[model samples]
Target: MSHEHRHQSHPRIVARLKRAEGHLNAVVAMIEAGRPCLDVAQQLQAVESAIRSAKQTLIHDHVDHCLDARNSEAEREELKAITRYL
Candidate 1:
């Protein structure tokens, strides 16, 4: 596909990933500081959820833009690959 067909969610996904990175760093810091297990788990969960959301958004963009830019066979295979993520 051409560069013009690139997924539009790139920026949003990057932002979400950065937020998740921050949360993961905080989780590590909490563990190092001997913080409560529950608090650490909560932060870890937040990071996981953020990453998942970003992944879903990315997949949506791929379906909407990337796949549409490809041929039928490629699009079908890409759809299959996308379902594997679920």
Candidate 2:
């Protein structure tokens, strides 16, 4: 089977990443504004969580919609490559 990838969740994932980008910008502004370390750390954590969630969603979507069981060798390699980020 051909392993042409499809991303059904692209819009949602892009929105999520945009939110994370906004949060990251806020974190940078907070640091420049001399916000307390704890508050900055919390915002940074939120940004990290958002990015992680987006990544997992993308990876899961790829595995669900792209992987071909009949092509186990190639699919397994792709799975390993994608999962390394997690």
Query: Candidate 1's residue-wise lDDT over 1-86, tens digit each?
Result: 23344566798899999999999999999999999999999999999999999988878777666455446786678677886785
Q: Weakest 10 consecutive residues, lDDT, candidate 2?
A: 1-10
lDDT of 2 at 55: 89
Each prediction's RMSD over C-alphas, in Å, is: 2.7, 2.8
Top model number, lDDT:
2
Give the clashing residue pairs of candidate 1, or none: none
lDDT of all the models against the reference? 0.82, 0.85
Cα deviation of 85 in candidate 2 (Å)?
Answer: 1.7
C-alpha TM-score for every candidate: 0.83, 0.82
lDDT of each residue in 16-48, candidate 2, tens digit only: 999999999999999999999999999999999
Candidate 1 global Cα RMSD: 2.7
The count of residue-pair clashes in candidate 1 stands at 0
Clashing pairs in 2: none
